[model samples]
Target: MKLAFPALSVALAALAGAHALRIESSEVAPPADIRGEHQELERVWSVFSAEPLEKLHLAVPGPVFVRYDSSLRPVVTPEAAPTRGSAAGSQDDDESVEVSAGSAAGAVKEAGSLGSEVKEAGSLGSDAKEAGSLDEAAQEAGSFEAGSFESDLLANVTSHSRRLRAHKKTQDDDKEDDESDAPEVLVARVVVTGNSSELLNMLELLALKKSSNNGLRFHLQNADATAEGFLLTQVQLAEQHVLRHLTTSLSSVVDVAPRVLVTNSSETKVKLAVQGASGLLVNEPEAITLRDLDVEISGSGFVQLNVSSVQLDGKLNVNLAGSGAIALHTPSINASEIKSSISGAGALVVEAENLTATEIVTAVYGVGVGSLRATTRGAAHKQKITIAGAGNVYAGSVVANRTKVEIWGSGEAYVQVKEKLDVSTAFSGNVFYVGDAPEDVRTSGYFFWRTPVQPAAEDKYETHAAIASPAVYPEHVSVQTKQARHSVDPIVKKISVGAQSVVLSSHLAAVAHGPNALLVFGCVAFGLVAVGMFAQSFQQRRARRHYRPLV
Candidate 1:
């Protein structure tokens, strides 16, 4: 029993050392461009923005796609009124009033000039006026009274002139309001034919400005001042079964409604951001570079991104809070570092080279599964994974130099190690690895066990990076499996050889708590006692057979 104590403690310490790894600088910088820069493209834009006519012409170097923007409602214009004649009559009335006002102003000016001349003459002849009779002075006084009447008339003329100007301004303002109330006419219909392309080619030579890539992209939006807010109806096409080589096909709908259609000229890559329950399909035969992008999916939204190689700015963030699905597969991802977390029922599958992350978390609230196929070049590029709930991470295909893992619940992690693996487990959580065992380990748990087994068969859906695509999982299916079986391939693999007979077969230990721990220790003690008794009985039988009665 004392010997068993030393053996048990040594085994627990080894299990602790088996699981040990860490990641540095786990923060990912936010993307700078979500909805790419907006710029107008020449020639192609006229087809969407020009006034509706019976005929329309357009051309492009590549294939063209046209779609109606359902988010934009038709603009309803008010009926034209019979206000042309009334406006003309008001202008005529204003002109007549102006003429009469001008005549009254001229009479007032002439009367003022005569009054000034008389005052100057009266002042000049002061000596003569003294010699003159009082009668002459009385005549001059009468002329002064006449000048006062002219001054009052001038005031009345000025008042009349001001009234006429106010009336004219009021008429002009009413005319302007009438015109403004009239609605504007936007593109209502378009017709594209073979000749349209020829016309576009000719226009490009004549008026088109030299652009970087000259690649054109069309945008359909609302004609109202506020271009965003309404929901866009998306029509999904049939799924393609072709693998490795995939293509995107889009259909268009045309309607006689007022909408704004703008065009953008792309130079290198397209920056895209998708929100709500939207589906995004990205298929590029050549390498694709992305910077500053964000995507959020709710409900049944999904994203299928396949590229040859991808270059990230500084950070890439993807959140699947609902049952949404995301499949990001690429040959290589170039970046300083990356991090990811899954907290919903959704599934995320990723495959790339040298995939380093601070920690891949499967939160307590999460019921999803994550599959990662990555390779680290050096020990400094080690990865970390944490399983806190029922969420599982199948990283058996990942060949890492070092990995650090933590299991806080019943969740399990399958990893492939090249150098070292550090683990800490609580509750019923377990850690499984297939590679060289660690030389030293320590654990805080009471009981620990390690088993060796031959590698399981490869999964049919397994690729270089993922066990299976998220698409394979049916909608609303439970992420948890009934039992760990190799038949599923993705979740668990069956071991062959003599190691297969073991109930718990792996390279690491299983941590049990409370009653479970007591039960396991009791079984181990009983097995040891039974073996000791059997050996003693065999020895006594041999001794009796070798010596005769007393011997």
Candidate 2:
């Protein structure tokens, strides 16, 4: 909704109190104009200032989204006070912005120009010459008819006149005007209105400028203030679904934790990134690539990253709860690391070429919650995915050369590998191998299963096992199953077979040299029989010599 500056009653007391509102080197411009500059200023602003208005506030009870806009920033103004509206004009060179208030408004402090006060003080100091005449009158009267006591009084009067004259010179030495010390302050208000749902989302965009009312005013200060420094001081949210998309790039130093925030991204152009929890959603034609963003998304708001190009770099943290999910749809992802904590029943899914992380470390503690991806490019050097609780990971056609897949708790994990896959599962979850299964070497609770197409190998090796609790013993339960690839074509036919033996003729000739081997075996057999008879005779003699009876 288009909003206008409303008729707001400024607390005249605040502006005029002991600490008068003071603003220096800044002007109050139309706030609608500020929104247009947010996208244009991707670099540091040499000047800093603020714009304020009591415009319409959007109160949304749903979710809020922030995204970048390539379109021209619209220049709009809010409705002013009903009586006279607002008077907006600029100085002769258009370097100055001026706003005039109508009814129910307090006064605006203008730049100071001392007029009568300095002249009045100067006139008082000039009166010292008139006081000198009193000293002459006193001397004349005392000399003519006064007694000895009157002469002493005339001397005291002359001394008092000289001292009063010195006061004027002292005042002139320190003649700086007092009015120049205080800076001029611009007083204005920001008004927000909408349903609580809309306002919740809109509140994330609000920014305010705070200063001491008595501080000296600054002049020609750059008015490039950003909304990044906005503090989320007060937020009252109801149970409502609010969704919004906003993109902002600003340089603001945060003094307090903002109710909503996007932090400083120095020097590099942020291609596009979704560094939050819940979910990320974007479906632009020239999709924004995510890079160098750290966002933690909570609540039930889901974000989708459906951009044309996106990168996840730096340290990214994702937290999801309830029923919302964080989804990625076909985006180039290059991340240093992605750390996630999942609770409740939220799911994380990356479809097709939708997921890529150099190092992914995730923990899932909720029921049926997990991180699953169907396919990913093998651009990363190494990829690691770890799931805990009742969660698991599935890699349908991922092509990462160096990857590690791990699972914990009562959930199962099945992953397809192109190069190498090291898996470790604990508790009741079954570990299924997709392409190259592990060698049959038993450590503890893990068993290997071969694909159904390789049935002979599955039978040759132990395909399954009954987990044993040696403590409880002889009662055994059988466990074994054959896994088949999903939706595979059943038709197959042999193409060709070679009739020629592939072995080298030289190796066969080496065996031909052993023709005398049978003759050697016959001689060896005859020699063994003679040796056996001699041993038997010696054994009979030794038995007779050492014979004894048990009785």
Candidate 3:
């Protein structure tokens, strides 16, 4: 029984060795490839974390093997199988065969033992399969979760959002800067290309909104006296698209009303009307009207119609009509011709070098025409009328009736009278007898003649009065006469004579010579009588006069 026990022990030992070898060859060798595949799968999972699975598909060889290292368990290596021996002796051999059979049975039993291990390994494999299925499910779920997480992270990490936020901040800063940099609305400049009605309407609107103390004000360009304080109606303001402003250029045109209306503060509103080939109209308040009011007319072939007030710092060729007074201050009126009746309470001063008035009737304290003329009728009913021209006539009349006329010239003044006309001069003139006048009447400077007959011969001439120097004529003289129910008075005095001679005589008296000769003869006779009496008295008085009263 002791010997049998030893043999069974040896047999059991041999069976254990063979089982280990089988396990080592079958299970342990496969696990090496499995572990390596697991590492590769782990690397793939990391790659999927960054890039999409589809993108990694092209880089990887095949479907990646993923193995879960649950609990990080270590793999076991199976032991090698034991070797068999050859024996001799028939009986011994038979016994050895029995022993071997017993050993085989033992081996079978050992192999049976391996069945449990195999079953355990199969169970482990099943577990590994289940774990792999679970891992796949988790991986699938992780795909969605990772994708969602990546989307969320990307949304937050994107540069677009940051850039948008920065842009919004920049816009806010720009808005603040604009608000801070904006200037105050103290003055408003409006430019109008057309009429003044729109400007007037705008003014009315402004007036309605403005404070009573802060009234609207404006300045009219080249406004006449009659155009001051002109009133404008709403209708007029609407039809004209005139611009209104605080201040405007003077080169532009302004159409103002005949009267100017203002608020209680008496803030004058000025309107400007440009009347030229190319013109503009502007109406502005006086407060801000001091800026550049230069209105420039541009473009060729432009026509500007009737304008109320035009301040011309530029060229102008258009008609102007103002119901009010027109003030021309350094204004240039250039046109084919200018014809307008100017009437103003204020004086009219024309400082223009060239002015031609067809009919000028000025009623002012003073009127100055500098190289100007009234080609037609010019009446100056002012207190003083001064004509500085070399040829100027105060009156013109053609009739036998007597009329008072005053003419002044540095040259000669010719006066022709058809009827009995008396003329006096502080000068001298040549005399020629056309009618029946005696030689004495023709040769005298101061003489009285009535139907005097001219002598047939030139030698029968007589002298009335002669100057001592002859070269210098009297400076002060007068001529007056009353004949046939007529009285005449001279108007002009201190007449000057040049190299030309002048004649003076009444037409009726110049026809006869008896009256003039008789006056001269009577003066001579009286002179002789007085001289004889004076001589006789001197002689008698020397002989001692007696009682002359008794004789």
Candidate 4:
């Protein structure tokens, strides 16, 4: 029985050893769902597995779930357990249970309990599947995470705050740049409309950089102002603070029809130079210095200057009823001229070098140091003309009228009278004075002398009437003796007693005489002789009678 027992025990031991628990062709069936949620398991396997899980695709399927220990380690199953009452139990039962317990404890140390491992493996597999699905969806949607998972989540709140800070920083940079690049405009045009006062105020604002009050200052850098197409009723400028550096240039034509006053109080003085087509209607005084000023005035007004002077390098056309004067140092009417054709009571004084006039009427009066020439074509009945100068006087003709014509000069004066000349002057030259005196016309002077020219008898009444009038003689007259002289010709009948004696040569004759004594003496002598003859005849008769008979 011992021999039999030993052999049988050996056989039983061999059988039990051969049937020990072991994994036989372990195969992991894949779970039905595999996605990003299962990626943790994959990562765990990557950590635990010696080789890539993909290489073990044939082995690991579903979720790598299989009969496992607490550590999720693959559990090897025994081929067969010892029968309950078999001789192997009594021989190896304790060893087999002890081995199993050791294996269980090792698995617990590595992976935890079996239930917990199963749960974790399943969750990891699910998470991996979800991650895969999300990746696929992101690819399909054409989107990407800006950062990694943790980074993407944190960027939401933090990125907005970062962006806001960056935006503020950019704004600060822009402001810094703006401080260096401020914009500015060089020149601009402006139009102003209002009354004269308003217009003047605007001009003062632009030119002087202030309003009516000179105390205020403007912020503008350069003050240059101009005006056009403005109608002013009455405008005046402040006399104190007119800007001297202001410049105005016309872009178009302008017309100003009001009283304009321009004054200056600055030490440098203000100047206004105008060009283009412009007209001014000045009812008051306008003081300015003109360089190339072309001004036209159509109203009856005057332009008075209170400053140094006014110069015209251009033309001025004025039609005025009042008088206007120009104050100049060396006043000259240069090549640039002025035309003043005013008819109604007006006077123009040009204190210049020279003045020229075409025609002047009777109501016009002018005074100048230059030359004055006048021509008269119409008849004047009783005209009193006076011309006093060191210059010469020239006239065309003088008719027979009660006209007083006086020409006085320290120089030589040549006078030609076509009609009767009644002279009263101290003339120096041997005047070739020729003219017929009518019966009522006479010539008288201080030294009265005339060439002995025979009087024409055909005008006897005119000659006699002229001689009979004592008031019609020239005062200072000295006649030349070489010429033919005649006195009391047959054509001259009557003679006056107190008439001035006139010497007549043989070429000249006197036919009339006053009463003399020679003729009276001859008449008395003849009468006395006739009376003596009568007495002698009477005495002879008496003697004869006495001798014969007493008679």
TM-score of each: 0.35, 0.37, 0.15, 0.17
Off by over 4 Å in 1: 1-277, 290-295, 352-365, 374-380, 438-551
Q: By lDDT, highest first, what's the ranking?
A: 1, 2, 4, 3
What TM-score would you give candidate 2 relative to the actual structure?
A: 0.37
* Candidate 4: tens digits of C-alpha lDDT, residues 209-250: 222212111111122222211221111121222222221111
**Highest lDDT scorer:** 1
What lDDT does the true structure give each of the candidates? 0.37, 0.34, 0.24, 0.26
Please name the candidate that would achieve the greatest TM-score relative to the true structure.
2
For candidate 1, write residues 365-478 as lDDT tens digits: 245566766644211246677665556776765555666776554566776666666776555566666555434333333112432122334411224332222121111100
**Root-mean-square deviation (CA) per prediction:** 30.3, 29.8, 55.3, 61.0
lDDT of 1: 0.37
Mark the regions of model 4 whose C-alpha exceeds 4 Å error after superposition. Answer: 1-301, 306-311, 321-335, 353-551
